[model samples]
Target: MDLIQRFLFEDLDVRGALVQLGPVWRQIQRNRDYPPAVRSLLGEMAAVTAIIAGNLKTPGRITFQLSGHGAVSLLVIDCSETLNLRGFAKSEGPIVGNSISELLGDGRLLLSLDVEGMQQPYQSYVPLEGETIAAVFEHYLQQSEQAPAALFLAADGDNAAGLFLQKLPAADEKDADGWRRVHGLAQTVTPGELLSLDASVLLQRLFHEETLRVFEPKPVRHDYPPDREKISATLRALGREEIESLLADHGEVVVSDDLSNHEYRFSADEARALFDTPPPNLH
Candidate 1:
């Protein structure tokens, strides 16, 4: 089972989270058949998304999107506050380069948080400034949160994992050098260890001397249920003429939700029924 665990330094003003994904990661790629380079990049993003989603204080969803003009044109991952995830990647053609910059040439990262009761989702943009996804997120945390952070991420055919460490605003008073010491210890972790070791064992190995408080692990899963009402509303907005044209060309109007890996198909009779009543005023 995929899970995420939160931990804190008992004496120092720092917090951290660890996420390990196995079945969920495999499920995400089961239908996509992404290239090896693209798969690895998406897996890393999946891990990062889980960690961020797990920290949400309210009921909502978070989306991470990477877009550019390279071989891999777009990568998107959506994770709900409950850690339910669904994502997909789009490529222009064959992928060549392995680095983030090469795979996503001139790409920018966009993070959107849609919290409950908010009129609009809060969003932020981060430059693809690092070679690895971990580094990119670390830079984002530093810039957006105004706090130093250490992030390590890794993924393979079987699993994906991440380790995060951040300095609290009041960390300087609790332990003048706490953030430095903890960050240094975290740097010693290897990708192999992060992927294979249990959260307890890994934490002990990295910070054996620090007093730590570990929380219960929370489950994460890949769940994208069909939103029929939303899809119907979308077709209604497309207007009767467009829907009729689509049905005429293909004998049916088929709309695909890539993220959910599901399709909505409306036949001639069904499509006509949608317009039996006047469509809502989109304006």
Candidate 2:
């Protein structure tokens, strides 16, 4: 199981989020054989999503999207307020890079928030400006949120993990020294350390001198859309002639593109069953 833990600095006006993902990450990677670089990047981004979305106050979802003219064309990860997550990547050729810039040449990263009651969702975009995913996230927080923040992220193809720290707006001159000390101490954390240690051990090791208030952790799960709704939507999108031709000639209808990671195959009877089911929730 995967879990995210929230914590607060008792008197320094700082907050943090720590995430450790194991099964959830493996499940996502199991669906596709991502390249070494792509797999690492995706895992990092997924952990980042859990850290950010876990802090959301509204009932909604956050999506991280990256696109560029490089070996990898598109990558997207969606995390709901409840901590349900799903993600995938699309590439045109071999993806080779140890960092965001090398992998996504001239790429842009977009963060979109879809709040349930808002008339329209809010979005922000930034040029991929850093050597690592953690640096990119740190830049975004400083630029868009006008807050002093730091991110520590790591992944090993099998599991992913991350830690986020932010100085709250309420911090004053008295807390300035503490802020510096905290950041300085956090710098010692390595990618290997983040991926291997439990949240309690990692946080205590990093902030043993600071007064901290830790909250209970919550579980994060992998959620897939209902098969009935997904199947019906694909069947309805096809013209009658096309559907008939697929059934008569191919014996099954394929719903996804050739470049997609997975294909949805359905027989004529299975397609009909999809239509008989109730419609999925519009919201």
Candidate 3:
């Protein structure tokens, strides 16, 4: 089953998270036919997105976006506090690279956290600086959260998984070298182990000697339902003239949301009806 497992070190001020995705990862890629390298990149983002969203203390959503001027132009992944995920990757042409720097050439990574009851989402940006997705996120967490973090992410056509470790404030007070030791142990994890092993068994294999408390696993899934009304409202915003022009040229208005793998096609009559009805009230 696809799930995220959280754990704490009994004698240390450090916590960890393990996320494994099977069905949900495949569902996200159901609509798009990405190149092998691009598919792996998107899968890694999906895994890390789940891990980060699972750690949110409040109800909200988190988004990670990578924008670049390369073969892979954009990569977006959104995950809610409940672990609902949806995302897609946009590319200019055939992708040839396997590393983040190669795929994203001179790009920036943007993180947005929309917390409950907040007027504006919290946002941050950092230049792409790592060879892998895991390294990039590790740098971001260390810089933005001011917590030393180590992340291991891996994915293939079938599954995506990640292991995250963050050293809380004053972690050294509990055990001076605890964070370092844990980080070292975590680096030993192989991509095969991540995709194949069970969370509890994997934790034991990595940190068997440590005093740890493993929590119950929380489920994760792909949950992006088409919002027809919202899509209609968007068409309305484009104005009637634009909609009619599109209909005259193409016979229908088609709006594709690559991220959610949803398509909205409006017949000429349906497109015209949008303006005949009242727009949704903002308040």
Candidate 4:
């Protein structure tokens, strides 16, 4: 497993995190052909979400999903507390987007926080500025919420990386000398640096003089939703009528086959989840 580390400053009491994705980058590419602009956005989103997961406290998944009208219809970054991330994008052919506002037009971004143990999830929708993801996030902090957050992200073919900084409420507002100094230092982080440096090295390079405390690394893992058995049970839940209708309409949905059986069927897992009782656990 590749390393991702989180650190903090003892004297400054400021928290920081670092994450690098090389192998995971390939997994994302397996789904479809994504244009350069779309790929870059997803890359940045993945990196930022990883950092966000590291900083926030949660056992479940946090999703940064963007959907709107434009060349790029959708972009999703699903990140868990452990750092297992996988996602895909929907776009309209080859489209070059310089900013979120230009790409999404009149658009909005949805930040969904889903916990497996919880019944109700948390979500916030911030209007898209047609600017870069970085700019949109800045607006999200100032408008949607009160916390002032900054994000710097970059991506290459094999790796995606980001640095996120948010100022916490300090006891002394005007007297807080470290705040401005830290922010200025953070501003020195270039896109190339974010994509290149590892966590420890990056922090040391950025804040060499500050007293920093490094935290124990959290193991990151991934989960693939819904297995084949679950898929069949879900297909059966369409009351058989709908399933038959679909079969008639679209013929067989072939997943795979052996020498003897065709093993093809319609998929209705999503519909089942929305309408019918879930199948018994096969575990």
Candidate 5:
């Protein structure tokens, strides 16, 4: 299971978080042959997205995306409130010398909140100059969530982990001290601790004196994409013309009553069935 935990320091009025990912990290890399640089970016972004998703107030999905003129034009990550997340990026150019900024170009990092067509999602575009995923998100929180936040994100070839601390909104001016204390302690977290230690141990190590109320570790599962009806809408949105064009570009296209085809083509209907039913055990 993906190890994601949330903790709070009730007296200090600050919140802390930790997300340790490994098996899932390997899974993300399995389907795509991403270069070292791109994989690194994905690892960092994945951890950040997972941690932020865990803290989101909604139970639907949150997406962190980057698009524009860049080597990698897109980074799409879907974060479920259940902490089930899956993400991938599109490489617009060669993988050579690709940094996250170089990949995203002069793009804006758009953090979109999709609540399953419930409420209007929250969106904030931060300039891609964050250089690091952590920095960009810190800026986003200040501008969007109206909170000062810090993130410690690290990734190896096969594992990704993240830690987060944020100042809770308060009515008094004394919160500065609490924020400083937490922030200073947070600075001590090494990459090893972030990726290896349990959330409770990490919190205690960071804020030994502060009274921290730890919450139960929440279970995070992986969610497949939309269901059949939704996928039909998606496919229908493409219009019969587009579908025909796709078939013409190659061969014939068939819309089956049931989603079972023995080919490597885009079968939206079949793909949609994954969500209508439960996903096979990721384990």
Candidate 6:
């Protein structure tokens, strides 16, 4: 199953999140024929978004954006607090290589949060400081969260997985040495192990010696909502003649530019139903 597992060390003031994405990660890239390298990168971003957003207290969505001057110019992944996610990638120029620095030359990473009814979404930007996405985001957490943290991320064509460990602000001096021991263990996780192992097996293998408390898993799904209301309103205003003239060749209505690949293909009856019936919120 695609889920995120939260755990805590009983003897230390530290927390961790383990995320493994299978079907959900595959669904995001289903319609788009992204390059192999680009697909892997997007999978990594999706996993990272889940691990970080798992701790969010408010009801909202978080996005991870990567933009740069390279063959792959942009990649964006959004994950809602409910664990609904959707993303797409845009590539331009020739394909020279697939390494992080190669695909995203001089790139910047942005993490943005759009809370429900918030006047302004909170955003953070970090320069591509590491050769891999995991290293770059590790640096971001260190600077933004102001806490000592470590991460291990891996993705094959089929599955994406990551483990996050962070030391909470501790008041007791006695547990100070626990950080070093726990981080060392976390560093030993191999890419193959991360991508293949289940959450329970992986956690037991990594932290069997430590007192650990694991929580029930929460599922992650792909639920990118399309702007149907806006499209319906525009179609109604245009009337039948104008609307048919506009979509005569294309045979569909584009809700917005953001939905480059997902034009609402409404038949005559479906078109009428869209305006007559209220559309449910995107899950």
Whole-model lDDT per candidate: 0.88, 0.82, 0.90, 0.68, 0.71, 0.81
Candidate 4 vs 6: which has more lDDT: 6
lDDT of 2: 0.82
Would you list the rank order by lDDT, best first?
A: 3, 1, 2, 6, 5, 4
| Model 5 per-residue lDDT tens digits across residues 1-283 | 3777788877767887788888777766655777677777778888888888887776667888867677777777777777776777677557766455666667888877878766688786768667777787788777778888898888777788888888887712545578887788888888788777776677778889887777787665554533545444555567666766766665644453211111233554444443355434433
Model 2 ranges off by over 4 Å = 245-251, 257-262, 268-283
Once fitted onto the true fold, the runs of candidate 3 whose alpha carbons sit more than 4 angstroms away are: 276-283
Q: Report the candidate with higher TM-score, 2 versus 4.
A: 2
TM-score of each candidate structure, all chains considered together: 0.88, 0.87, 0.93, 0.80, 0.77, 0.83
Model 1: residue 67 alpha-carbon error in angstroms: 1.1
Candidate 2: residue 258 Cα off by (Å): 12
Clashes of each: 0, 0, 0, 6, 0, 0
Winning model by lDDT = 3
Per-residue alpha-carbon lDDT of candidate 4 for residues 1-283, written as tens digits (9 for 90 to 100):
2345776655554555666777676666654567778888878777777777666655677888788888888888787766777776778855865677666667778988888778877998877763787777667655744666667778767788766666565613533676667768888998778777777778899989887778876655444543566556656655767765665666654443221112445445544343465566666
Put down candidate 3 lDDT per residue, 1-283, tens digits, no spaces.
4899999987888999999999999999996888888988899889988888888777689999999888898999999888899999998766786988788888999999999889999998898878888888888888878888988998898999999999998789999999999989999999999999999999999999999999989999898889988899889899999998999999999999887889999898999999998987877
- Candidate 5 ranges beyond 4 A from true positions: 96-99, 116-123, 171-176, 225-248, 251-263, 266-283
Native-vs-model 5 lDDT?
Answer: 0.71
Using alpha carbons, what is the TM-score of model 2?
A: 0.87
RMSD values, in order shown: 3.2, 3.3, 2.0, 5.9, 6.7, 4.1
**Candidate 1 residue-wise lDDT, 1-283, digit = tens:** 4999999997898999999999998888876778888988888999988998897667689999988888989889999888899888898787898888888889899999998889999998888888878888888888978888889898888899999998998899999999999999999999899889998999999999999999999999987777876788888889999998898889988888988777888888988788886655755
Better of 1 and 5 by TM-score: 1
TM-score of 5: 0.77
Question: Using alpha carbons, what is the TM-score of model 1?
Answer: 0.88
